[model samples]
Target: MPVTRANAMSKENKKVAVIGAGIIGMAVASCLQRDGHDIFVVDPNEPGLGASFGNAGVFGTSSVAPMSMPGAIRQVPKWLSDPYGPLAVRWSYLPFIAGWLARYIAAGRPDRVERQARALRDMLGRAVDNLAPLVEAAEATAVFHRNGSLFIYRSAEGFAKDRQTWDLRARNGVQWEELDAAALRQFEPSLSSNCTYGILVRTNGHTSNPHALVTCLAQNLIKRGATIHRTAAIGFVLDGDRLRAIRTTQGEIPVDAAVVAAGAFSRPLSRQLGDRLPLETERGYHIMISDPEVRPKVPIADQEAKFVATPMDTGLRLAGTVELAGLNAPPNWERSRILLHQARGLFPALRDNYPEDRLSLWMGHRPSLPDSLPVIDRSKRSPDVFYAFGHGHVGMASSGMTGMVLADLIAGRRPTIDITPFRANRFA
Candidate 1:
């Protein structure tokens, strides 16, 4: 039998430590536990309160387009000049991030962008299917629905300008339906008449509550005999090429194998493991209304405005934006306010006089790599240490598949996809 196949049937289970309790970590812990491995998760903050909490709630499997495209570099100057634009990088922090910015722009090369898109599509194409079993096992199916997603454009010209993106999506085998103004309005009556063109991805879907799903997954892992330590992972203890234990604020916990899915904080840990990844944070903002007057049957994205409005169980969530200010800088709440204004423009029926108590404003860091792909490979320094972070905007959509692939790597099995693109040594 193959080494991985032998391990699968060994009957000797190993203790695996997952160093994060967000959606990614919880998902990985759940997968490893199901495979009969002893699982332990460690994190300083409460699980599900990070980026996993404030996401747009859309599981965009068909969203395989990379943010870095042929013309993206030229748009950066204008985007940075406009404070309220969809993408912005602080001028003061430019000098500090100059190196990463250069690489980010370089990834926009035509050939590179296409390669990134294909890799992302391969990993996220089966997002809903990959997550279904886990969602059902956790009894959280109510949160996720395959109602598909809608992208509305302000005009035919605007939609025409995005033909390149649509073409790329088509090349990746993404299914969709184009709707005229009348059909679009009938499909999502909540959308204002200003949105004249609509394209609905028939295979896409979203969650009504992202935080609830994360909580459900975490709870399910705990119920399945997995231990969760509410402590910060400070470092790791390695014995030669193998990891002996993970050092945390509470204490050192021994482990036979480990996964670092700490989101934006995975950079320092990666550096400690001898691979200096160019991991940066895209601080994303969201505004949630507790009781909305109007609700969309499915999630809708204003293609021109660069924001999404997803009808959640509690209310409608308006979320999007890419702000680069590193990890320690304070959030600019104005960005969240801007999202509210843009959302109102898209949906005119939203009452301006809604109670202030019904609103929730949030900002969280999204771990990202320049190439717009995550590191789902093993650490170059430690044989037993694996990496699974830098997912950018697709973290939620890709979490299930990421967990499955990482589990296979941990079990010494060849993953179903080519993970070479996500290797830690890529940056090196």
Candidate 2:
């Protein structure tokens, strides 16, 4: 937004071009437009319908923990061998993935893990508070549901393992309540007897339809005079220390400022601009059972398989797993089957949830950083270039806060939160 700068006479007219129409990009565009900047959003898809479309949609502030934790690095070998393991790296992709794994392994150190948690807390802690007003303005209150998320444990030992993470969440001021099996059954009457202790993160929420949320925001952006360009953000036209325009197949969209939020696709684009970001894609899969009539209102996080059962508008989505395969790979049905099997285990009634033909498959590569803290800092090398990608599994969770920070950066105001932790050069 063009705010009255300290140099009052020099009205800095800004034309902000956002790359990628994922929730992050859309949110940034929406925030900038709302703040009075001329806005344009460019992406291959119209808006949403990619990672933003099929995401689990959990608005989890409790996710201050990174994807690579203390013991996660050692599990890579086991995960690679086990088809149904929670994580995997394909052998064909090993050479490339190995580099990513090296970064991930270093991030698992105690000091790095602590920094990752703090940075994640900083990124996500104020996310909902900042973004909720924007959703309210869009007039799609129904899309954002505040029913909270429950983490159900399969055993008492599992519950103990859960405490380690929950303790971290609590330290960061995330509100939660420990619920025993009896308390869990009250809300999740459908849960099987095999599940016991649970942690109810009341601060959490989810989107019933993420596509609808992004669409509503996009529509609102258009109404507010922001242009939505249906084109892929292939690269950028580099000026000295800045990206003067975003390069797309349609043409170069000339601009004063560009925000690269192209998700996993951002690495190459950033690299071309001389910021070789440590961005990798965690390829994930989901199985959706369309419109299950009888469903629990709140979402469930299964501790056993590390998956999430989220009831959506069109269907109930079982989503999770972190596979470090390249983009454009075929959907792994084994992972999808593993999701259904986990769903059935958690909710015995789901065995007859839907017709086999009614099930749908989806695969998306969520852009991940070594620390799992998304990059939201300005490119140290380029003043006109900013980054908002690498949210990993928490894209939806952190999008709102990301947008707010982006708007602040663009408006040339001191951002409300410190940006040092999310700097793109942190890895370098």
For candidate 2, lDDT tens digit of each residue in 1-428? 22112222223557888888889988888888878777778877878877888888899878898777777666667766776778866768888877777888888887787777887888788666666888998887998887688888987788886566666767777888878889878877898888987889877888988889999999999888788887887877776776667778887777778899888888877887678887888988888987663476878898777889998888889899877778866767778778887788788877644577779888888988877888887776678988999989899988988998998988888888778888888877
lDDT tens string, model 1, 102-191? 888899998988899889998889998898888999999999899899999988899998888888888998989999999999998888
Model 1 residue 73 CA deviation in Å: 2.0
Stretches of model 2 off by over 4 angstroms after superposition: 1-10, 352-354
Candidates in order have lDDT scores of 0.86, 0.81
